[model samples]
Target chain A: MLSAHDVTRSFGGLTAVNHVSLEIGAREIVGLVGPNGSGKTTLLNLLSGFLAPTSGEIRFDGTAVSARRAWQPSRLGLRRTFQLPKLPARMSVLEVMLAGGRLPAGASPWRSLLTPGAVRREEAAFLDKAMGLLAEVDLAGLADHPAGGLSGGQQKLLGLAAALMDDPAVLLLDEPTAGVNPSLRRRMADHLRRIREGGTALVIVEHDMGFIGDLCDRCLALDKGAVIANCRPDELSGNQQVVEAYLGRRRPGVPLRVVAGGTAGAKSSGARA
Target chain B: MLEFCLHVLIMSAIFGIAAVSLNLQAGTSGLLNFGQIALFGIGAYAVAILTRAGLPWPAALLAGMAAAALGGFAIGRLGRDLAAEYWALATLAVAELVRLVALNEDWLTGGPQGIGGITGLFPGLDGPARALATLALAAALLLATALTARRLGETQFGRVLRLMRENPDLATALGHDIVACKVKVLAIGGAMAGLAGGLYTLYLAFIGPDQLLPFETFLIWTMVVLGGLGNVAGAVVGALLVTTLYAGIPFLKDIVALPSDLTGSLRVFAIGSIVLAALMLKPQGLVPERLRRLHAQRP
Candidate 1:
């Protein structure tokens, strides 16, 4: 389980994440939903140890990880994926997956040189495992292709596969479905369910309300770096604060009909006009 | 002519070793190390200074390697939070600092005049035979370094390095201490460069502050780029081609009757042109690194 308590991060005078406290239980799929600049991604970064919070604590499996290095959380089985996949140029897709796997004993330069035969064997085994993961993500055909050459959707899939390589206990995925196709998105929703069933917790940041409502058990809606609503995913559309925050609060004299038009000008001018 | 040929071969081998070392750092690890010659210089100076202090040749050589490695580790540590471009600038500054120290320290480094008349490894052999013996040693070390570099690229350590190079954030998020990885890469590369420097001093029986110039680092970069940035074989080929071109320039001067000072300028121009042409025409160099098709392999 992972928990963030009163975590606030400020850049200059502007607070990006303000007094955010949340808990992720084992195998739970928590959807983080917010408008642009709502601090969803910043929250993910803070939770994943990519950015140290300005104040408060983030504990993973009861270990305080707020001051730890970004790699330290992942070493404790807290993994994450970027909104834009971070695949390097000239590196093959399969190699990316292998890098995500359990750090091999042969990863030590001394062991690699001293017992090359064992290193080779370990690499061969990892290679096989990587291929299987690639197949699962339908990226097996592109395994040898340069990762940099992958399309946005494919790169997202590769990011997921790579994160899964180490069998992480918790995965913080930022916009996994943003560039993905509808069919692939549906398949991914199913795959994520299967992953959760396999005991891996997931915190997904997504813009697609339908995807979140359909796939997530619970959803947290954020507005201006503060949590506006915390409710079951299906109840999100009906939550007044969530709707007001996402759709914008209606003017005092404006008819609900005019507000439904959802334009700045239309909302400012009442339906009576 | 034989002596000239031997000199070219020996110099090519020595520079070849340094080039391969640079490729490992710049190519594989994605470190933009403009201080490479400083690492090389540290070894050369360590050998020259420690040997003059009456240390045994083997001990002095090892000391030189250790010093270079330590210097490299320091560079890695200092550049930990810097972006690649800034880190590169920092390395350049570090190298210039080292050169200034060598130039200013007269008693220890023999000043800009440098230490000379040092004993060579094969001093017992007659002139041609001695040159041949040195060539043999240089060539053997070059081969060993190239093979070691190749083997290193195939290992798990190499995979992590490549990952760190490409995406440090992702590599770190995947449970790798990229700082530690960077330090290890630099130390390893520094040791290799140090070895090349030691061999260089041993062969020429001399070393000076002039040898630690930033231009010397760029020369090795040219070799790495010409040979195909990440490929060990390419670095060697590039080193051989460039060193031979440099050595052959004196003969060109004799044939063309060029001014003596102009010839030195000409060498710089020639090297600059080759690097420019290589970047524009064949950016991958003569021998590009082979990408591993791990999916094609069976368990």
Candidate 2:
């Protein structure tokens, strides 16, 4: 459903994403794994049209979409969630999702003021759709809550629900499980799986190897802004470069420990464990 | 006492309109506009100029609102990319520029002599007609603004505006044309300010550059801050209270033999103290925005 050909982005002299190519098919959950500053999020930004690639071609549903503005790409069914979960502090969770639902295609000021009945009808439909999406993410009860009031994990879920409100053909999520609790993380993974099954293409950036392994159908690893490996989850985990990049070689007598616990320690240890 | 209450109600209704408009820009849109008085000034001048041009009161009032909206559109376009402190500075500059224009523009604004003899909403009728008309006009504007605020609160545009205020980056990523939305709101808000200016001109039967000072801008800010920043009802209440204190404090001089000249300064001092007290006591204003209530209910 989405394709990036030789995408390259640079900041001054430093290249953030270099000649990276990726493809995400409909109903596919593709995992993008990398260390810090590896350009996974940058790649997502370029694809979602938040940042224009210095050089590359991005195609969404067979149309070239590399140079459009962020909001413009959204019309073409390209949606994204930020790594930081950019929820508006002044807006309720429902309002935020309604914003997504009310994408330019759904409402305009002129139409809204002139055709109140039609706008109300569409608004009701959109509200139902937003409510359903919120329920899917277990945020139905928190719909009236301000988006800023959500816990980190809940905000991440709401972010995904908001993206889904657009009825996106492809959703790009940046670090969905980054700061979430383990249970919430697991739920997020499961939700991603359901989203994939429901036929939307997903490209997820994550540091959690377990999440990638559990939720993704295919995985790609990046090192220094370049793709190092692209394969099935098991193969990706075992790939020599991927393993080397994520887990440096242990000394001969240093016992390699795989500490498994909650998300807080896991995140800290996962970085340099 | 009854006269004082009526005066308070009238002044409150006027300020409520200003505060609501200011809140729409600053509280909801997150645009630090320090030049709102410019729009207010334009509104008053529009009415003044149109009335001098022999237009009827109602037509002059609408013309004033249109003028202010046009000014707002100009400012919004000019300050579109400015953020935070820079935006505030730009708006302040614009307000000063407008004031200067009003002061120097002789033929149109009467050039410092000010404009007077402007008729009220009803001219032929005596006390009751004039008072009723003023009250009715004020009520009509307040109701219109309240309805507008309610509609905006529920709409997608309102959500985007709030998102833009909190985090423009997120709003942009989520498919909001932040600049366009800001411009739209700014113009609409300017129109409201203009409406207030028109009403003020009719009520006082005068227009002067002195009314467009930065101090007046701060007064509007004070009203919004006293009322919850994002709460429409809070703005209304705050406007009423502030206007009452402003109009009534002069009576204190009659009771206490304070210097007559000190009344103006004391009234301003009183307003500043009240604002400071409100900030300390209820920093979120009398009625905080509904977002807080929603969030508080969350598990």
Candidate 3:
């Protein structure tokens, strides 16, 4: 489980994430939706240890992790995927997965040299584990291929696979369906479902409303870095304030351009418009 | 001619070690250590200083490596939270700082005249024989270094370095202590370079601040780039090829009418040209870095 208490982050004069709080239960797939710069990613960064909040406390499995290093949270079984997958360009697809797992014995330079046979033996086991992860993401064929050479969707899948290697308790995915095709996007939704069933909680920020609608048990909509609504995913459309936070002031007889077919954008304008 | 070739071989072997070290830092970890020569200098000076203090050769060499590792850890600390470009500049500043200290600390470092009467691998051998002996010792060291580097590359540490190189954030999100990883990488690389420096001082029988210039750093960079950035074997190949070009140029004195200074300058120019060509055309170098296969264990 993961929870943030009134998390607020600022940059110079601009407050990026302002007094936002939410909680994710075990095996819960919670959808996080917001307009551009609504502090969705920034909040995720705060929770995932990529950036420290100016004022807030985040707890993972009952431990305060607000000051933890970027790597610390992951070690605590909390992992996050980047908005733009920053996969190592030169590493093999399999190597990417192997890195997500625990550090093996004899990682020190001299020990590695002294017990190369042992290192190799462990590596042989890692190879099999990585192969299985790759197969889950339909990337087994590209295991030996350079990870950077993958398409955007495939890279997303690879990133997912890499995180899955950690067998994390919670995953903060920035945008799971951003560059994916229709079928792959559907597959991603199914994958998230399976992962949720496997007892892994997810906090996903996405513009693909249909995917969010299908995957999320509950949805948290953010506006100006604050939580505007928390309700069942299916009930999200009935929340007038949530719709207004995402779209412009509602006209008396106008059907708003909202959540259009789970696309990357939902033709919405904020209150300023 | 045979003696000249042998001399070139010995020089290449010394350079080969530094190339391999740089590859570990830069190629494997993406650390742009512009102050690598400083670590090299640390070793060279350590050997020169320790040997003058009546220490045995092996002890002196180990001291050199320890000094370099200490210096590297310090630099690595400074490099924490720095971007790659800033880190590179910081490393350059360090190299300059080391050179300045060596230059001003005349009583300690022997200033420009340098320390001499240094021990050799086989002091009694004739020119060719000594060269051959140095080559043999260098070969053994190179073998050990290559195997160690390869083994390091195969371990989880190496994987973390490779992953950390291009994607520090991603590696961090996957449970790597990014700053700590960088520090370890620098220390390991610095130790390897220190060993090379000690060997250089032993083979040349002299060392001065002149030998630890930024130019030496650039020369090593050229080799790593020319042979292939991430490949350990490429580093050796590049070092040998470039060292040969450098060593062979002086022999052109009798055949060509060029002045000695011009010939020396010409070698540098040629080296620059080759690096330029490599960057422009074969940026991956003669051998590019590639991830090792998982083998047929599961495939």
Candidate 4:
């Protein structure tokens, strides 16, 4: 559903994302994992049209979208979320989601003012869709509340819900679970899985290995702006380079402790407290 | 005394319209438009020119609104590419350019001589009929503007504008076309200023380039700041208070021993002091935007 060819981006003398190319078919959930200063977010930005690739062509659903403006890409079925949830402080959660829904094809000044009944009906439909999306994200109760009042995890959920409002064919999520508690992170991962099952492609950038392993169909690892490993989640755990990159070196003398009774459920309940 | 108070009230109504428009562009849209007076001047000139060419009052008034909207559209286009401070400077330049054009375009505007002998709102009416007509028109404009402000404030468009003000990056990420939204706001605000200008010309039956001066721009800005940024009702109250002070303070010369010239300077000084005090004590004005209300409501 989304493809990039020879995508490379540079800032001044620094190459942020160099010669990176990837593709994800429909209904596939792909996780992009890297250490700090890795080009995961930059690659996502380039794909989403927030940052123009210095030398690359991005094709979304077979149409080239590399040259399109950031604000126009969502209409072409490309949507993304920032690492930090960027909700407008003044807008209610429902209002923010409504903004995410594409503007009607015939929305012009004359139509807006002269056809009040039509506008009202369109608005009601958009509101209903947004409300349904909010319910899916478990944020229906906060629909009327200003989005800024939400906690960090709730704001992330709101952001994801907003992306879903457009029924995007491909979603580029940057660090969706960075600051969220494990339980909410799991819920977010589950939401991604459900979205993928519904035929939408997702490319998620995350640092949490457990969440990515559980949710992603395939994991792509990057180091120094280049892909180091592209493997299945289970294989990624056993890859020698991946293990060394993440943990320096595995020691035979020290046994790895597998903590018990520390599921995402416990974390979420603690967060509620 | 009653006649003077009524005149002051009428002038205040006109100012209220201008202030509300200014608040829409500056407060709600987060644009620093320093050329609101230019729109007013465009409105006044449009009305005067069209009326002189034999058009009816209503048509002339709407023509004036259209003229101001065109000027606003031009400024909005410029505002799209420019940042706030640059946009403010560009608007000021545009206002001055309009005034210069009005001054030099003697064949159309009659130069410094100004336009006069224009008909009143109700041409055949005398006394109460004229007063009632003017009051009714002003009240209607105020009511319409208030409704527009309220509706726009509650809209998805308004939320996007506010988002632009708070975080341009997030606004873009959320799919708001910032430049288009800003232009729309500027055009709407310019239209409001034009309406005020048409009303003012009808009341005074005169138009002059001096009316579009920087002082006039500052006065509207002061009204917006004093009333509260982004609060349409506050603009009304602020305009009424400022106009009352502008007209009422001159009456104090009748009771005081001060000379007219000294009292004029003293009034100017007083206004400056009040603005400074307002900036220091209540920079947000008496009625801040509803977003601030949300902040206060939070735990």
- Candidate RMSDs in Å, in order, are 2.3, 4.3, 2.6, 6.5
lDDT (CA) per prediction: 0.88, 0.82, 0.86, 0.80
Show where candidate 1 strays beyond 4 Å.
A259-273
Work out how many backbone clashes candidate 2 has: 0
What DockQ results do all the predictions give, each relative to the true complex?
Answer: 0.74, 0.33, 0.67, 0.20
Where does model 2 exceed 4 Å of error?
Answer: A62-68, A86-90, A103-114, A247-273, B1-7, B291-299
Say which prediction, candidate 2 or candidate 4, comes out ahead on lDDT.
2
lDDT of 1 by residue, A1-273 (tens): 999999899999989899999999899999999777889999999999999999999999998885457788888899999999958878899888888887566678778788877887777777778888888889999998999889888898898888888888999999999988999999889888888988899999999988898888899888778888888999888888776666667778956563344565443342223
Q: Write the per-residue lDDT of candidate 4 for residues A1-273, one digit (tens) a residue.
A: 888898888999989888888888887889998766668888888888788889988888887775346776777777888889767676678777776776552134444555667666777777778878888999888877888889999999998888887788888899999899978877887888888877788899988888888888899888667777899987887887665555444356965543475434433332343
Candidate 2 matches the true fold with a TM-score of 0.89
Clashing pairs in 1: B227-B234
Which tens-of-lDDT digit does each residue in B14-97 have in candidate 3?
Answer: 889999999999999999999889999999999999998888888999999999988888899997978899999999999999
Q: Distance (Å) between predicted and true CA of B111, model 3?
A: 1.8
Q: Considering only chain A, what is the TM-score of each predicted structure? A: 0.93, 0.88, 0.90, 0.87
lDDT string, candidate 3, A92-127, tens digits: 888888888875564566667777777777767777
- Where model 4 places Cα greater than 4 Å from the true spot, the runs are A66-68, A103-109, A237-273, B266-280, B291-299
Please write out the lDDT profile of model 4 over residues B217-259, one tens digit for every residue: 8888888888898888888888988888877777788898778
